[model samples]
Target: MFAEIKNIKSEKSDLRKFGITIGVILLVIAGFLFWKEKESFQIILAIGITLFIAGIVKPNILKP
Candidate 1:
């Protein structure tokens, strides 16, 4: 029981880490896009692609 509880906690931690990493990456991308004068649609597209790649690389991190 304790092991299961530990596993659950660790999974939540991993998810948090993944979220933070993605958030930072997106912020940087947004900054760069703004600097380059890109359209809002382009920024949204970049975010979608980033998330798609992240999901492929870490499917487990996104599990519910």
Candidate 2:
């Protein structure tokens, strides 16, 4: 009952490496599209870069 529900909520799924990689690439490309009119996308690119870097570092950190 409660224990079963707790176990389900406690599980943390691993990040999807392949999908993240593709998204990071797309973000980088979109970041370059600077028309001075489309400004919100730059932040998205920055976040993507940050996520990519974190993804790389996370694996290394966990490895023995």
Of the candidates shown, which would achieve the greatest TM-score relative to the real structure?
A: 1
RMSD of each: 8.5, 6.7
Writing each residue's lDDT as its tens digit, candidate 1 over 1-64 gives 8667656643645765665567567767777777888877466557755655555466455644
lDDT for residue 25 in candidate 2, whole number 0-100: 83
Instruction: Please state the error at residue 8 of candidate 2 in Å.
Output: 9.1
Cα RMSD for candidate 2?
Answer: 6.7
Q: Candidate 2 lDDT, tens digit per residue, 1-64?
A: 8667545422112333633575588576766665445777777777676666655555332221
Specify the highest-lDDT model's number: 1
Model 2 scores what on Cα lDDT? 0.55
Query: What are the TM-scores, per candidate, against the unseen true structure?
Result: 0.49, 0.44
